[model samples]
Target chain A: MDAKVSTKPHEMLAATLSQEMAAVNALIRTRMASEHAPRIPEVTAHLVEAGGKRLRPMLTLAAARLCGYQGEDHVKLAATVEFIHTATLLHDDVVDESGQRRGRPTANLLWDNKSSVLVGDYLFARSFQLMVETGSLRVLDILANAAATIAEGEVLQMTAASDLRTDESVYLQVVRGKTAALFSAATEVGGVIAGVPEAQVRALFEYGDALGIAFQIADDLLDYQGDAKATGKNVGDDFRERKLTLPVIKAVAQATDEERAFWVRTIEKGKQAEGDLEQALALMEKYGTLAATRADAHAWAEKARTALELLPNHEIRTMLSDLADYVVARLS
Target chain B: MDAKVSTKPHEMLAATLSQEMAAVNALIRTRMASEHAPRIPEVTAHLVEAGGKRLRPMLTLAAARLCGYQGEDHVKLAATVEFIHTATLLHDDVVDESGQRRGRPTANLLWDNKSSVLVGDYLFARSFQLMVETGSLRVLDILANAAATIAEGEVLQMTAASDLRTDESVYLQVVRGKTAALFSAATEVGGVIAGVPEAQVRALFEYGDALGIAFQIADDLLDYQGDAKATGKNVGDDFRERKLTLPVIKAVAQATDEERAFWVRTIEKGKQAEGDLEQALALMEKYGTLAATRADAHAWAEKARTALELLPNHEIRTMLSDLADYVVARLS
Candidate 1:
C-alpha cells in the first residue's frame, strides 16, 4: 500500500479493531433486545443498522488499545458509548421533530414521537446496564457525569439556540454538553478501565473533548458550505430552524443595526423569506465568520493532537492523531 | 392518635421520616439545579413543588429506616428514586400528551414537549449521578434494570394498550414495568444500602412490587369509578383514550360477538362516542369484571402485607403494611 493512498482515520481504526468492533456490535445487539417489547429492537436496529460511522465507539477502542489494554471490558464500554449516542439521536429527533437522520427517515418520524421517546429511554437504560456490567465504579461515575452534562447541554441549547444574546461561550457550553461530554467520557472511561495513570486518563479525556468540539464545529460550518447530499443535511437548515451556531453568533456579534434587524427578523422572530438563507450567507461572508469558525475548528483539532503528546506513542495513537485532523479536514 | 379520622400511611411515613425526607427534599433541590441552564431548575421546581405525594421516595426511606439503616446514603438514594419518578412523569406527560398531573398543569403543557423531554433527560442523568455516588455496584445494577423495565413497559403499553389480545399476564408485565419496577427498585436499594441480608432485601422487593401492582390496579379501577375530585382524573378518561385496563380486558375476554364488535370499534378503532364509556362500564359490570379487578387489587395488597412478615417488626413496617391496604382502599 502506497503512503500517498489516503484513507480515513476512522476507517483505518475500524479495520484495525475489526474483531473488537465485532464484539461490540454483538453486545449491542444482544443487550438492545427486549424479550417482551419487540419494538425496542425494531427502533434500535433501524438506527444501529443505519450505518453510522460508529466514531465514538471506535474512539473508545482506539484509546484503550493505545494504552495497551488487553481486557474485554473495553468492548463493553465501547458498546455503552454507542448505545448512549444512539439514544441521544433518538431523543434529538423527537426534540427537534426532525424528519431525517443519517440520510433516512428519523425514528420519530417513521414511528411516532412516543416510540421515539420511549425507545430512546430504553436505550439510555440499556446503556446504564452495560456500564454497570463493567463493574468499574470510576467508569460509571465518568459516564454518569457525562450524561448529566449532555442533558444539561440539550436543555441549554433548547433555551438558547435562537436567543440573540447567545455568544460563543454559551455555544461552547452547549457543544460540550450535546457532543463533547460523551466523547470525553468515552475516551476517559477507556483509559480508566485500562488502569492507566490519572495523567494518561486526563490526556485521553482532553483528546476526546477537543476532538469532539472540532467535530461539531466542522459539522455546523458544513451546514452552510458542504454538499447537502454528502452531509445528510440541507444548506441553511440551521438558519431556517433559527439555530444560533458559532459562525452565526460571531457574525451577529459584529452586526450593525440593519444586520441586527435582519437576524432579529429571520432568526429571533423566525420570519424567513426566499432570500433569507442567501442574505445570511452574505452577512457571514462579509464578516468572514465562516472562515473564523473553520479556524476555531482547526485550533481545536490541533489541541486534540497536542493532548495526545503525553500518551504512549503507538500505532493507534498515530491513528487518533490523524482522526483529529480528519475531522477538520472535511473543511478543505 | 386519630387513625380513623384519617392520616394516610404515606403521610404517617412522611411525618416519621420528616427530617430525612426534608434532607431528601433539600438534596433534590440542590441536585436538580442546573448551573448553566436556568430553564432546568424552572421546569424541575414546577413539578418538584407541585406536591406529588413523593410516595416513591417515601418507600425508599421507609424501607431503609425499617431495616435500621444509620447511614446518609439512603437519603441520596431516596432523592434518586424521586428524580427517576419525576423524570418518568415528565416523559409520560409528553408521551401521553397529558395536560394535567396531580391536579396541576403538566410540565409538557406548561412548557413544551421539547422542554419536558430534555428536562426529563436531565433528571434521568441527575438520577444516574446520584446512584453512582452511592458507590455500590449492586444498587446501580438494580436501578439500571428497573429503568430498563420501566422504559420497556412504557413501550409495551404503547403497543398493547388498545389491542384486545393483550391478556392478563401482559398487563401484569406492563404493570411491573411502568409502576412496580421502580417501586421494587426503590425498596430493594434501600435494603441493599442498609447492608441488610439477602432475605430482607428480597422481602422488601416483594413488598414494593405487590404494593405497586395493587396501587396501579386500584388507580385503573378508579379511572372508571373513583370521584374526579379525589382521583384528579375524569371518569371514563381511560375509555376515552381507549386504554385496555384490567376491567376492560376482562370484559373483552367475556364479550359476545356483538360486544367484541363494540370493543373493536371503540377501543381498537378509537371511534368512541358519548355512550361508549357507559356501554363499556355496563359490560364490565354485567360480567362482574370490576368486582374481580377489585378482588385482584385486594389480593396484591394482601400479598404486600404478607411479604412484610419476613422482615423485622418496626413501626415503618406497620406503616408499609397499612400503605399497601391504603392503595387499594380507594376501591371501597
Candidate 2:
C-alpha cells in the first residue's frame, strides 16, 4: 500500500508513454472545452483534471506505435478512445449513484445528474468527431463496436445485479463488454489503422482483451481483500450495492442453503445492516472465492502474455506484457 | 387538430419512408432485444413502440433517396439516427423528471432512473454501431457533430431553465443544438453519402435546418396556445418548468416591472401554483410574444422552402417543401 509500490506500474507505463500521453491529454483538453456552452468545460474539466490512469488511450498509442504507425492520426484516435472512456465513466457514476471516483467527487456528485448526462453525451460526440478526423472508417467500426459492447456490458451488469443465478460465463461476458471491449478495440484499431496483417491485428486485440479482463477481475478481487487506501475505494462497496461481481457469483454458486438465504436477504432484498459487510467478507473467505477470482486473473494475464508472441518483439510489446502481469500482481 | 390537417404533411413523407422505417424498426427490435439482459428489451420496447412520428429518421431516408441513392446503407443510417433520438428522449425524460411521453408512462416512470440511463446508453452504442456499418467517415462526422450539439443544447437548457436573462440569441442557440442540429445532420448525411454535389448537399442541410427550426418554434408556440389533447402534451408545460423557450424568452424581454415581478416570483422563485398558467398565457398574448413566435416559425418555414431551390425539381423535393409548410401550419 505504500506510494512507492503503488505508483511503480503507472510510472513505468508513463515513462513508456510520456510523449503520446502528453498529446492525448492536450487533445482531450482542447476537445472538451466548448466556447458556446461554458457548462461543458466546467463539467468536463472537473473529471479530466481529476487524473485517471489513462490506460485505455495508452493502449491505443502503444499499440499504434508498436505496429509501426508513423502518422499523427494515432494521437487523435488515442484521444477519441479516452473521450469514450471518460464519457462512459461519467454516465456510469450517474447510473451507480456513486459519489466518489478516483479519490474525488464524481461529476454527478460535484455538479448534478443533468450535467453529467449531458456532458457525458458531449464527450461521446467529441469522440466521434475525433474518429472522423482520422478519416478511417475501419477505426470508427472498431471503436463503435467497442462502444456498443461497453453499453451492453453495463446493461448486463444492471440486470445481473443481485441476481444469484448469474454464473461465470455471464460474468465474463459482462466484464468483456464493459471493460475489455474498449481495451481490445483501442489496441486492435491501432493495428488496424496501421494496416497490420489480419493475424497480428487479431493478436493485438486478444492481448488487449486478456489484459482488460485480467485488470477487471483483479479489481473485483481487490474489493474483497485490497487495502482501501491503495484502491481509493471502500472495501465491499460492490457488495453494499448488491453487485454480483465475479467473486460473489462464484461464492453464490457454492453457497449452502443458509448462505443462499443470507445473500437473498442482503443483496436481492436490500436488507444490509451494520454487520453485512463483515458477513459478506466472511462468506467470501469461507468459500475461497477471492482466491479463485485471483486465479482467474492470473490465467488471463498469462493468456495476454501469450498473445504478445504474435507481435514482433519490441520494447512496447514487452512493456505491455509486463503491464499485464502488473495488473494482477497486487493480489500476491 | 383534426387528423385531416395533422396527418397531411407527414403522410407523404411517411409513406415514402415506410419501407425504410420498417427496416429501422426491425433493426431496433433486434438490437435492443438482448439475451443476457431482459431489462434492455423491456425498457427499449416501451419507447420504441410508443407512437412517435419518426420524422427525424424519415428526413435521413428521404434526403438519401432524393439525391438518387441506390444503396441500402441509408436504411442503416436512418435507424442509427432514430436510435440516437430515442436514446436521448429516454434520458431527457429522466433528467426532466417527466411522468409521460407520447401519451404513455415515461421509461423512467415504468422502470427507474437506473434502467433509463443504462438503456439510453445501450441505444447510443447501437447507434454508433449502425453508423459505422455505413462505412462513411463523413456521415460519422455529421452525426457526431449533431450529437455534440444536442448535448450542448440540453446542457444549455438545463442551466438556462429558470434564468430570465436568457435572450433570443441564447434561446435560438439552444434550439439549434437540441433540435435543428440533428435534423440538419440527418438530412445532410443523406446527400453526402449519396455523392450529391456540394451545392445540393448544402441545400439539403439548409432545408433540414430550417425545417427543424420551424418545427421547434411551432412546438414552443403550441405549448402556450395549442390544444392539450391534440398536441398530446400539457399546455403551459414550459411555463411550469420555467424553461426559456422562444415565447417566454421574448415575453420576458418585453415585460413591464409588474410582469417581470410576476415572472420572478413564479419562474425564478418557483412560487407558481396551478392558476398561474392562465395569467402567464394572458401576459404572453398581451405582449404579442405568441404572435412573434409564430412569425418566427413562419419565417423559418419560408427559409426552408427557399433552400430547396438549390435542388432540381422532383417529387421528393416538392414533398419536402410541403413538409416545411406543414411543420409551421400546426401553429395556426
Q: Which whole-number lDDT from 0 to 100 does residue A137 have in model 2?
A: 80
Model 1 per-residue lDDT tens digits across residues A1-332: 44453488888888889899999999999999988788899999999999988998998998899999999999999999999999899999999988888878999888899999999999999999999999999999999999999999999999999999999999999999989999999999989989999999999999999999999999999999999888878898899999999989999999999999999999999999999999999999999999999999999999999999999989899999999999999899
Regions of candidate 1 where Cα sits further than 4 Å from its true position: A1-6, B1-6
Which prediction has the highest DockQ against the true structure? 1
Please write out the lDDT profile of model 1 over residues B134-224, one tens digit for every residue. Answer: 9999999999999999999999999999999999999999999889999999999999989988999999999999999999999999999
Which residue pairs show backbone clashes in model 1? none
Scored against the native two-chain complex, candidate 2 gets a DockQ of: 0.77
Chain A TM-score for model 1, please? 0.96
Weakest lDDT window of 10 consecutive positions for candidate 2 chain B: B1-10
The CA lDDT of each predicted structure is: 0.93, 0.87
Question: Candidate 2 lDDT, tens digit per residue, A232-273?
Answer: 777888888888898888878989999999999998888999
What is the i-RMS of every prediction? 0.6, 1.0
